[model samples]
Target: MSSFAGVSVLDDGMLCPSTMTFVSTSSDCGYHLLVVKGYARTKETPNGQSILSHDFGVGGYRWSIKYYPNGIISDRADVVSLYVHRLDDDDGKHVEAKFSFSFVDEVEWQNPVYIRGMKTCSFSSDASSWGFYKFMKIDALERLMNLDKDDCFTIRCDIMVCNAENDAGGTQVLLPDIHRNLNNLLHNKVGADVTFEVGSDIFSAHRCVLAAQSKVFMAQLFGPMKEGSASLDVIQIKDMEATTFKALLSFIYTDSFPDMKEDEMSQATEEEAVKYEMWRQWLQNLLVAADRYDVQRLKYICEKELCKNMCVSSVASMLVLAEQHHCHRLKEACLKFIQVQSPSCLQTIIASKGWQHIIATYPSVLNELIAKVIASNQQLVLK
Candidate 1:
C-alpha cells in the first residue's frame, strides 16, 4: 500500500495525482457522498452564477455541481438553476447515472428539500448535464436560509453510476481478468525458479507462485525452516508418488487439473475401461495428496472426479479413501451408489478385497453403510 503525496511524475512520464492514485483492486458497487458546505452564503456574481463544488471524483471521472441562485437566464429570474456537470477528459465518453440533488435542512435533518424525482442521464461532452432551471423558487430558498441559526446551508448529491463508455457510443470497459494471465503464465512455465524431486521425477516451478498459492508451500519453501537456495534449487518431497506430485503441482500452478486424455473416458471399449480405471486411481491418490497439502479446491475436484467413476468394483475402495480423507461428499456418494442407486452393488463391494480392509480401518463408516442398507430394507418392507 502506497501513501498519496499530492502530485508526482513517474518514470513512465505519467502525471499521477494523489486523489486519483488509488484504483480499487476489487469490485465496487457503492455510493459516494458529495457534501457542499456554506451553500446559502455562496458568492453569486452579477451574472447570477456560482460554482459550489468542483473536481470531485465519482465512478472514475471528475465532476462539478453548478448553482445559480438567481437563475441563469433573465426569463427564469424567479427560480434557482442547478446542474451536475462532468469535468473529466472523457471527451467522447459517456457516463450513465441516476442522481438526486437536495438541500439539507439544518434544524430537521430528515426533512430536506429534494429536487422531486431521481434524474437519470447519460453524460457526454455534447449532452453533459441534466438539471432543473426551476430547481426551487428564489424567495423560498432565502426564507429557508434565514430560518437556519448559523445562516449556513447544506446541499447533498446522491449518485448511482451504472457504467462508463470508451466513446459516446463505444463499448463499455469490462471487468478485470484476475486469473486469466496468471493461468497462462503457469501453463507456459515461464521464468520457473525452483524444482521439486518426487521419487525419481523432477518438476520445475516458481517459488513465489507456490508460496503465494499455498500456506504449506509457503512454510516449507519461504518460512524460517525453509531450505536455503539461490536459484534452480531441487527440494525433495517425501511420501508422494511422482504422478501425484505432478498433479498437485498442476493444480497449484493452473488452478485446474492437468490436461489428460483419460479425462474424456466416454467409450466402452476395453482400452477406454483401462484408461478410466487409471484415471480413477490417479484421482484417488490426488484426493489424499490434496488433503496432505491442504488444497481444498483440488480435494473437491478429486472428490467430484471419483464420484463420477464410482462402480461396484471401485465403491469399497472409494469409501475407504473418502473416510481416510474425510471427504463427506464422496463418502455419501459411495453410500448412495451402493444402497440406493444400485442395491446389488453393495453385495459385490462386500466380497471385494478392500471391503475387509475398510471394515478393519473404518468401522464407523462400515456401520453407516450397514445402517443405510437396513433403512432401505425397512422402506421396502413398508411398500
Candidate 2:
C-alpha cells in the first residue's frame, strides 16, 4: 500500500452514498468525476484477472477504469491493480489529468482511501491507458470492504484536461495593403484639405492626418487655444523649411521615412554635393521640428542618421544639437566618439568654433564631460 502525507479528508456531502462532486478551479482546467460501485463482489470471469467500469466523459473524451481484485503483476501479488483507459481513439492527441481513486467507508461515511497525482498520457494505436499495477494492498481493500454496508464501494476520478484542441475558436483578420494605400495617399495628396506656406513654397496636406499623428498639430488645429487663422484654409509656418516640413508630413502619413539612394554622396558631382548638403541640412532642421512637435519616432530616426554621419568636425555641433533637443542617445554617441574613437578628436572638437558656444549655452554638458573623464581615469588607476 502507498502512504500519503498532508492529505485532507472532506467530511461534508463529498462522501455521500450515490453522489460526489469534483470542481476544477483553474480557468484553463476542466473537471470530471467518475464513481465506481460494488467493492468486494465485482464480477470476474474464470480466466480474467481484471474488470472494467462503465465509461465516462471528461473534456469531450471517453474514459474508463480497470480494476484488478488480486494483482496484475507477479511481484505485486499482495496488492490490487488499477488503471484508467481512454475508450475513444485520441488519434495522436495528448491529455493531462490530476486524478484520485478512493475507497469510501460505509461505517464512518467520511474517511476514504485516496490515490491521486498529476499525470500526462498520450494516445496511440499500441497502448491507450496508464496507472499503477500495485494500487493498494489486497488486505487493506478487504478490511475496507468488510466495513461497507452491502459489499459496495465508491471510487472517484477527478480529471483536469489541459491543452485541448479547438478549446478557443475564432477567425483572425489581417490587413496586408494598408501601408501601400497610406503611402499613396500621402505622396499623391489625392484629398488634400489644408495648405501650408513656408517662405515662398506651398504644400498641400490633410489637417486630420496631421492632427492624428501629433499632439502639437492637434492643439494648433482643434484645441481650445487654437490660432485664429488655423480654422482658415491656408496656415503659414515660420522658421521651418518647405523640404523639412514635407518630410515630417510624409512620416505622419506613412509611419516611415521616404526611401533615398545610399550612394548619392559617394558619386556626387559639385551640383549633386550641393543638393546632398541641402538634404543633410534639411534632416537637421527636421530633427529639431520633430522634437518641438513631440513626434518621437521621427526624432529617433533623425538621431540614428546623425549618429551614423558623426565626424570630428560635426561632433561638437551634434553635441550642441543633442543638448538643445534633449536627444540622449545622440549626446552619448557624440561623447563616446570624442573619448574612445580617437583621443585627438576631443582636442579637435574643443578647438571648433561651436565649442565656445556649447560652453556658453550648456554648462551642464561640460560638467557631464568632466565627470566622464574623471570616472575613466579612476578606472585606469584601479586596473
Would you list the C-alpha lDDT of every candidate in the order shown?
0.64, 0.62
Question: Candidate 1: where is the Cα deviation over 4 Å?
Answer: 1-180, 187-191, 224-232, 341-345, 380-383
Q: lDDT (0-100) at residue 239 of candidate 1? A: 86
- Per-residue lDDT for 191-239 in model 1, tens only? 8887888888877888888888778778777885575545337788878
Task: Give the runs in model 2 whose Cα sits over 4 Å from its true position.
Answer: 1-176, 227-231, 266-279, 341-344
The TM-score between candidate 1 and the true structure equals: 0.50
Compared with the true structure, the alpha-carbon lDDT of candidate 2 equals 0.62
Residues 208-299, model 2: lDDT tens digits: 87888899888777775475553547888888987788888877876656444433552448977666665566667889989988888788
Root-mean-square deviation (CA) per prediction: 21.8, 24.8
lDDT at 202 for candidate 2?
85
